[model samples]
Each structure stands twice: as structure tokens, then as C-alpha cells.
Target: MSRTIISSNVRSYFASLWTATLYHAIRQSNWIAIAVTGVFSLILFIAAEVSPTEGTWGISKASWLSVCGGVFASFLFLCIQSMLSALKATNRDMYKAAFNELVEKHGIKTVFSQRGSDDVITLYRKLLSSPRRRIWAIGMTNKHFVDQHLESLVHVLTSYQIDLVIAFWDPSTTLIVRQNGGRARSIIEAQSALEGNPGSKWGETIRQRQLRIANAVKDQPIRGDVRIVNVSSVTSFSCFIIDDDLFFFPFLANTDSTNDPTIYCAAEGSVGRSIIDHFTKLLQNSEVCTTTYHQKETTVVVPMT
Candidate 1:
């Protein structure tokens, strides 16, 4: 450990030991304090009884002196005990302040053990069910999210004029979506130690989903004009904002987001707002493409031979 840390720890340890052992060693008793004070008081009483002193109202001088000395010693002990109690309270407040600062620094409210777990999905459903004016996403194709939460999304988006935006990685420039500074692996290099799947193999084009959303918007009471856009920058995380809730997922090597941890925070928090700002910039800088379905897609089936 660093010198400062070790010194602080050592200081804290002694302070605690002093508070506990000298004052509160026994839960229901103060034997040590009583004994130490008793001995000191006895010495004071003895010294005062031997001192030469005057008497008041016919009281013996030695008797009055000893009495005053004993009372003074008792009061001193009481003050010391009170000081220790106050010290403990101060320490507790300091610790609480430190914890609050840590929480503020990260702006994290909850850390879901696993992303896409039952509780996480349930929370998403609940958040979507609420009345909202818009929804935003930053992720890959977002097919997985749509396919998985289609019902909830449709229900919520249709409940009100909650617009949706899906800003996904542009597949053309996403040939290598590794972490920043990650060395590029050859396409021929098979994914082995890691399920190092190439970017192209994932996130299907949003062309079709856009049409579905368009159709819903045309007929549904709610505005479901899902704007699908492409982002050229590489990302190591996916963020989704539902109402005031922000869900952040940092990708792990070869692991699907569903298996990774999820950080949930309020949109107003420092972490959440910063991420939303970045996503807003991504959409603004990239030309957002809005697709309108001219007509229902038709298919001609060949006669079976």
C-alpha cells in the first residue's frame, strides 16, 4: 500500500482501538473507565485530605477539600467519556460522506448482475410501459433488442407519440469494430480462444425494421416513426435511454451483451447525461435516414414442380 494510505489506516486503527478498548470494551459496562477514574479520584482525595485548608460553616477543612477534589475528578472523567463519544460520531459522519462522494462520482444507481436478465428485462418493460415522448438507442443493428422486446416496444410506442431512434454502426466502415487500439485480426483468422466474431456477421441491416415501424406509425394512435441511422465510429459500449432511465452496457470480449453487466442510472445523473449527449452528437453528425414504406412488400411464389 502507499505510504499515505498505510499511515491513514494505521491512524484509524489506533483511534478505533482507543475508542473501543478504553471506553466501550464491554457492551453493558465501563469497568476500565470506572477503575482508572476511581484510582485517580482516590489519589486526589488523599492529597486534598493531607493539604492545609480553611473550613466553612464549621465544616472540617480536610473533609471539604477531599470532597471537592473527588467531585472534580469525577467530572473530568465524565468529560473525557463525552469527548470519546463525540469523536466516534464524527468518524461515522466522515465515513458516510466518503460513501456519498463515491456514489456521486460514478453516477451509478444500480448494477445489474447480468444484462438482459429477468429483472433487467422486466425493468425495461416497466419503463417502456410508462408514458414517454421519445426513446433513443446506441448499439449495433438493434435487431436483438427489437426481436426480444418487440411486444413491449410496440405497446409503449403505440400508447403515445413516443418517437424512437436507432443509431447503429455503419456496416461498411465497421469491418473491424474492436476496442480502441485493438490490433486488427485477418478475416481468415478463425475465432478461437475468443468468440471473436467479425462485425459483418452481426447486426442485420435496419432497412426492414424501418418499414415495420413506418407501417405502425401510419396506422397506430402513437407516432412510431422509428428513425434508423448509421454511425461510422467504433463503440465499446451500448446505451439506451427510455424516458429518464439510462441503461449502459460495456461489451466484454467475445461475450454477448446479455451476459455482461448492466449499469442503470437516472438520465439526469452525470454518467447518464454525458452518454446521452454523446449519442445526440452521433446522430447529429451522421445523416439520419428516415425510411417510408411506399407499399407493402409483395412476393411472387413460383409454382412447385
Candidate 2:
């Protein structure tokens, strides 16, 4: 009777151990390792219980079985860890390779040439000539101040017969204008106000202003006309020109409260060169201006002129 009771207790303990191990493995999503360990543990438990010899070499069969079970479990756990490590390494390599390919295919190059003041102008010229779909300029202003600048810009473009559009955003207000006659309002702002009720944060406000500007330019009345859009912040003015047949050009300005005469220009030249190359291949004229200080010296690149 005592022998029977001891054997039953040993079986119950082994059963509980196996159940706990499986529970943990399942929780961790390691089904394969759990299965292997469970089968081996069951086999060890059975061998210990059914063995005819109660004691072999002065050690009980159950004691040896317990030790073997522990070693097997440890080995299986190591195997799972090894598999997970290998998978993680493979994923990391794939991500790196993908990123490198994208950079090679579409990454823009920066042109760093010239020295001192000339260097800055050269950089600006490059940016102005770079081929791009759109450019965005930002600055600072009040309602009347912006209107004055907008009138001047429209007059200049009209004098050149360049098709254009103007978009505006001021907190809860929005407006759009084209040469012929078209107007729209701030849908994004309205939606944002309804859904999130977001307060006036700098980033959010800037984003809203940009969105309104982009929408106005995109929905311009002309089908194939190039767009030159301008906007401002509290301290600066920005200009963006999107030309389908020409390279992109951008002009930025910081209002001189201290009465300084210095102006800065940032241009993407390598992109401009690429665009010129494409046009040259197609036997088309691609004229672009590469200059930093429009006030000091104007550099204009006209087609073979």
C-alpha cells in the first residue's frame, strides 16, 4: 500500500510539472519546443514508474528520471531561443538592404562647391535649377501686409504672362484665388476642429497653413499651367514655383527688423543638372538660373544664349 501511494504521488508531481511547462511555452507561442519537451518528459515519467527494480546502484529510478527530464527541458528551451535569434537577424538584414536600395534609386545629391560668399550663391543656384514637382516658401505677416505682397507677386507673374494661384490660411479662415476666378475654403481645418478639437499648437498650425497652400496650388484653374505660391510666418517670407516644363526654384526671405541688407538663397543644383540632362537627351531647351544673390549679381542660364 505504501509503495502504491509513493508511486501515485510521484506520477501526480510529474504530471503537474509537465502541465506547468506546457502552459508557459504556449503563453510564449513556442508550440514546437513544448511538444518535444512534453513527449520526452512523459516517456521519462513512465520509465521511472514502471521499472521493476525499486533501487538501482543505490539511487532510485525516479531520481535519475527527474535529472534527465531537467536536462531535456533546458536543451529544448535553448533551441527555441536560437531560432528566435536567427529570425531577428534575418529581419534586420532585410530592412537594411531595402533602405540602401531606395537611397541608390531615389536619393538626392548635394552640390558643395565654391568658397566664402560664392559658395552660398552656388548652393542657392543649384536649388533653384533642381528638377522638382513643387516648392514651398513660408514667411511672417498680417492680413494687409500679406495682401500687399500678394498683389506685387501677382503683378509680376501677370506681367510675365505666367499662370498662377494664391492660397491663404489664418486659424479658422481659408481662401484660394486663381487668375480667371476660383475660390475654396479650409476643409482640413474644419475637419480637424470637428474630430480632434486640437488647440493652437505651432506644429499643427504650420501644418494646417501648408496644407491650405498645397490644396490651393493643386486645384488651380489652369490645366497645365505652372504654379508659384508664396506664404509667410512671423519673421520670414517663402516662395515656391512648380513648373512642369522647367526646373524648380525657391526663394526665402527673413524680414530685417534691424535694417540689414543681406538676403539668403537655398537651391538644389544636382537635381537641376539631372533635369537638364533629361531635357538635353530629349532635344528640348532647358534654361535655368543658378545664382545666390539676385540683388548683387544675377546668373541666368538660357538655352544656348
Candidate 3:
């Protein structure tokens, strides 16, 4: 084998040996094997002092014993440090292996608690750098996504032709909105004490959410067409698909979707595929959203029938 291969093999062997030694040291009780060597060295010191021999093999007995004991202690100290360093390195490798395993099993890439954070934005910008053919976003209103990502989308639109679809829960008609103790308008007293405020914002239904989409993309993109799929109740999570990456997260009842943990998955993978399939079926059964906007086109409003 070449020198490089031989070096690699040797390194691997030492790494394994060091790791094994560390584990063995951890498993051993206080009566460790190294302590026996220390005891033997102590006995040698006593022998050196007790013996009357001035020298052996032209070396003073006491000095020889002292040198031997010093060498033994130095070697032991080096072994301990090497093993500790090895243990530290192996732990890091174990963490990487575990992370890879999770990614393989669930198609889960990055998982962070806050959505639309700097990390999410950075990831999107990087993804936009690649050649993208299609982009689909799914969520409850998806207002947060549009607010943070529309700038990058505009920039990419100038560069390449991409098919963009924004799928959101119909704010006015979705039953998935917080029922807030399951109290329906008909059941609750119109002027009861329970009605502390006359407003509900689990979703902002004040203006058609499609208006936000329309306005965000109204500035005609020379390349991309933005479409909307307004579904009612299949809104399990907020999802954004840009090419092969699917970004998604849950909707916390009391807080914004941004407060939930967002998950990244490969668009071709199982988790992403299942989500896409559900939306596809919903789109097939879709009605034209209340407010429709495609880049550079006149905004069209469809009355709920």
C-alpha cells in the first residue's frame, strides 16, 4: 500500500485503541491496573534504600530505581491524557453519527424552535442560489412567509423562470382556526361576559389573506407565476417547498406559527411527499381563492359561493 494508505490505517488503529482504553478505564474500579505499576515502583524505591549495593552494572542502584520510577510515571501520565483526548473525539463523532441517523430515518434535516428566524432566512437565500423549477408554500394564511421571503423571491424571479404556488388556509372559511374553548358564535351569548373582546386573531380574517399574496407578488416578476391553493382544514403545519427542500412547522394555538419548531426535509423524501400528496388532492378539489394574484396580472376577487 502507498504511504498515505499506510498512515491512514495506522491512525485508525491508534484511534480504536485509544477509544478502547478510555472505555476500559471508565469501567475499571479504583483498584486500577496502572496503580499496580505504581505500587511496584514504590517497592523498588524501598529496595534501593534498604540494599547496601553502591552500584549495579556501573549504575548506582538508587539512581537506577529512581529513573525507572520516573519513566513509569511519565508513561502513565501520557497514556491517561491520550485516552481522555480520544474519548472527547469519539463523543463528537458519535453525535454526528446520531444526527445522520435521524436524518435518514425521518427525512428531517434542521429542526429549530423559531420559524422565520435568521437561520431560516439564510437557508432560503442559499437555496434560492440554485436553479429552481418549482416552489410551493403551504400554511395557515402564510403571511409570515410572505413577509420575510418576498424580497428574495423577487430577486430570484429576475434571474430564472420558476413556477411558484402559495397554498394557505382560507382565513375566513377554515374550520381549523382556534375554536377557543369550542364556543361557536351561535352558542356564545352575543353580549356575554365571556366576550371580553369583540375580536379574534387566531387568523387575521380582517382582509382576505389572498390580498397579502396578491400585493406581495403584484410587482410583475418577469419570470415566475405565483398561484394560490386556499384549502380549509388540512392545515397540519406551515410548509414551504423550494425545489428539493421542504420547510415546515406546526401552528401553536396561542402563538404564531413562528413560535413552533420548524422541520426541514428533502422534498423527494417520505415526509415531504406525504405532505405534498395531501395538498395535491386538496388542490384538485380547490375552488378559486377569494382574491387571486399572479405576477403583473390584475387582482381578481371571487365571492365565496
Candidate 4:
């Protein structure tokens, strides 16, 4: 009788253990639990069969317990698997919904045409979910010319209420400029020329051109909160974020007629990937991706800061 009671308690314990394992597996979407429970059940079944006193409880009772335990375990495993599948489906649906919302709100015509579209989209959705407002523009700068993309950039920054703008200057192109006839200038010098050019009519003409560009997009004003930063230095990380919203990187391309502008806009593969990796680390903590309008092969991953 004592043996019978002990066996009964053991059966009850396994039943409860299996039930708890099932609950956690289903709730947390953990697959490891299924394996653990299966192993544990196997061990229990082997012990029952090999124990010398098994017949003392009667073969009928032992068989019934074995069947019940197997059935319960199987049921729990199936239920957990079903729940996990459902959970995955639900997550995909939620991501799709959020992406659609972003498109409607910001007028994002397209996203993620590259190798890691799913991952990129997931990161993008996470970043957009945040309350922070930031915009980042990646372009080139050199001694002779600054890429004229600033006008479009200002419009984007303003629209996003960006608090900062990080501009990446590629050193490789600048080296090319130095090798050529032109010399590379510091960011401060470039910025001074841009914002506080000397009292020359030429400077004034450039400023007027800038103002006209700004005026053309009167519908979108530079956000009062935005500030420009020129990042001429390259670190282990190259990506920069404006208010945690936008990411920018330089891409290697064919240089134009003027050697000076080459450094300002030339894209170097090594430098570009380094910058992307850096930003990927930063954005991943918050779950975001660096997306582009024209490129289809690039994938942006947010890295750890």
C-alpha cells in the first residue's frame, strides 16, 4: 500500500511538472522546454518499467498511469507548438500593420529592396515606434565643393523635426583630391565658407544660391531645433543619427569633372560599411535599420553603442 501511494504521488508530480512546462513553453514561445519535458518523461517511463516493485501496484494500474502520462505530455507539447505558431503569425501581422501606419504618416513610398529586407523592415518599424525625433544626412565634403544635396536634406530634416544632422566626409576621396591638384580642407573651413564666407561677391553668390534652394521648398522649413554637424573623422563606427530618426553613410561612386568635389561626394566601400556597422550597432539597441531610397543591395544593422 505504501508503494502504491508513493507511485501515485510520483505520477501526480510528473503530471504537474509537465503541465507547468507546457504553460511556460506556450507563454514564452520557448522550444527548449519541449525537449526538456520529453527527456524527463522518458526518464520517468524508464524508471517505472525498470523498478523491481512495479508489479506490486498491479500491471493494470501501471499501464493506466503510463498511458495517462504519455497522453498528457503529448497534448501539452502539441498545444505549446500551436501557440508558438500563432504567436509568430501575430507578430508578423503586427509588424505589417505598423509599417503601413508609417507609410501613411510619413509618406514613405518604399523601403527594404535589399538582401535583408525583413530584418531591415523590422528594425525600421522599431525605430519609428519610438517617440524621439531625429534626422541624419550622410554626404561628402572637400576643399572645392560640397555636395549640393544639402537642400533636399534640409527639407527632410525639417519635415522630421530633426534635432541634429551628422555629415560624414570620406577621407579616401579627400586623399584622392590631395593626390590630384586640390587640397582637402577641414570641416570648420568648409563650414565657414558655407555659413560665414568672407566678404566676397562669390561667397554672396553661393549664399544666395543656398537661400534660393531653401526658398524653393518653402512648404518645408528648416526645423528651428535642427543643428548641423560635420563628421570628418572616421571611427570604428561611421553611422550617425539625428534625434535617433535618420541614418547616413557615404557610398563609393564615379567622380565628377572637378577633382575638389570628388572627395566631398566620393563613396568608399570600406568607409561606407564601417559607418553602416556603427549605426547598425547604435540603432539595434533601439531596434532600427538604415534604409535608402535608391540602393537595393545594402543592409543596415543597428550596432551596440
TM values, all candidates? 0.61, 0.29, 0.60, 0.26
lDDT of 4 by residue, 222-293 (tens): 443432223334331223333423333222222321211111111223433444456446433322222111
Give the Å error, residue 70, model 4.
13
- How are the candidates ranked when ordered by TM-score, highest leading? 1, 3, 2, 4
Query: With candidate 2 superimposed using the best TM-score fit, by how many Å does residue 3's alpha carbon deviate from the native?
Result: 65
Global lDDT scores for all candidate models = 0.62, 0.39, 0.63, 0.41
Superposing every Cα of model 3 onto the true structure, what RMSD results? 11.0
In the predicted model 1, the residue pairs found to clash are none
Best by TM-score: 1
Candidate 3, residues 98-170, lDDT tens digits: the string is 7776677557787877777889878877886754687787766566667777777766666778877777665
lDDT of 2 by residue, 94-129 (tens): 556655553334333222221123454344345434
What is candidate 1's local distance difference test score? 0.62
The TM-score measured for candidate 3 stands at: 0.60
Error of 3 at 155 (Å): 6.9
lDDT of 1 by residue, 1-305 (tens): 69999999999987865665444334424545666777766766676567566655677777776776767678577657865765675567556666576456656778997877999888877777775676887775666677776667667665666657766655444234456366654222222114454444432345565555454444444444456565665556788888778898876665454678899987777787898888877777735322223211121121111
Candidate 3 ranges beyond 4 A from true positions: 1-55, 102-109, 122-131, 148-159, 172-182, 185-207, 211-225, 268-305
